[model samples]
Each structure stands twice: as structure tokens, then as C-alpha cells.
Target: MVRPSPTLRPLLLAGLLLPLLVGCRYTYLPLIPAPAEVALPTRVTSAALTREGGALVLRARVEGRFEPGYLSVAWFDSGRELGRDSVYLDAAQREATFRLEAPEAGAYRAVLAFGGNVLRQVELYEVEP
Candidate 1:
């Protein structure tokens, strides 16, 4: 049987442990922001949330020329999802509105998403009766 010499054994052990120690350190690279030209087209120009009596209303103004698609507004309460509402967008439609029953008085957020990407979010706090 062949065996490593005493001097070679220490070198071999150091070689293996050196990589383990060095690899344990992680270096994260900073994210590069996307250029404005390559950014997603702004289909929704503005969105607002309002409470009307017993319902929450979402009014989003859309401005762009794109193929017909669906825009969705998902309601969340303290990180728990309540429900989602979607509206169809045609070429001629200039705005989208969604009305949903208001949840119990609490903090809520409405996320506006299009093409699987989030475009805007509106936070609303409903006062207790």
C-alpha cells in the first residue's frame, strides 16, 4: 500500500480545508437597474382606491396601445390574501374599475398587476364602525 509522506499529508489536508474555508464566504453582486428604454411599457398610468359605503373601489387609468389583456387587482389583509378581481382591457377602453365587498376594518393593500407583473399598489385602512 502506498501512503503519503508526513510532510505531504499536512499539505494535502491544508489544500482540502483551504477551499472549504474560502468557499464559506459568500459575495453578493449588486443588481443592475434596467434601462428606461428596455423597461416594461406603462399601460396603467394611475390607480386609486376609495371606500364607498360598504364596498372598496379601484379606479385605474390606462393609457397605451396594446393587445387585449386582463388586468387584475388582488386584495390582501396583513399579508393574507382576501380575493382578486380582474378586468378585461380592450383597445378602446381607457379605464378599469373594480368593486369588491370591503373586508372587516383593518389594513389592506390592493395590488394592480398586468401580464403577470405588478404595476402598482394602493394601501387602504378601513376604520371600525
Candidate 2:
């Protein structure tokens, strides 16, 4: 049997373990980059309600390219929810319109929402012409 010197034993052990340690080093790469700040592709710029031919028409100015989603309006009178209406928007859409029954003469509020996110609130008043 042959015995290695103390210094040579450590060197032999290091030689055997060095390759394993080197192989164990991990190189990590992120699959996705960090998020960047960007504006939404579709947004409601303005909204209004008008009475036409005994009906209320909701017109919402949708600015930017329309993504396929639902643009909705929730009608409220005196802080009580009255009704809700929505229009399906596609890539070819540029504006949103919702026709609703004529509300009684009173002060009302209309909330415009897109993709379930509230975008704008409009105060409406209906009076006899």
C-alpha cells in the first residue's frame, strides 16, 4: 500500500473536487425582461349623454386603437344604481355608443368603464324640452 503525504493528499482531494465544484457553478438567465412603463392601448378620453328622440344616447370618445373588450356604462340616479349597459368593441372600433331608455327628469350620474375598469364619470341632467 502507498500513502500520500499530507500536502499531496489535500492536493489530490482538491483535484478530484475542483471539477465537481466548477460543474456546480450555476449561470442563471432571466426569461423575461423587467417591465417597462407604458400607457394603455385603449382609453376613454371623453364621454357624454344626450337625449335624442325620447331616448338617451351615451357617446364615449375612445382614443387609441381599440382592443377587443367591453365598454360599459352604469347609470345611477340619486346614488342608487339604476341600470347598466355595455357595447362590445373590436379592433375596428373607434368610438363607443350605448342607447338607453329615457330616464325621468332628474339629476343622474353615468360611469363609463372599459374592461371592468372605471374610466370616467359624467353628470347628466334630464329636463322637459
Q: Which one wins on TM-score?
A: 1
1-129 in candidate 1: lDDT tens per residue? 999999999999999899788988757655565566643475678888888887888899766655678898998777888899898887787689998787457777899988787889988877431
Model number with the top lDDT = 1
lDDT of candidate 1 vs native? 0.81
The worst-scoring run of ten residues by lDDT in candidate 1 lies at: 31-40
Q: Candidate 1 has what TM-score?
A: 0.62
TM-score of each: 0.62, 0.59
Q: What is the C-alpha lDDT of each candidate?
A: 0.81, 0.77
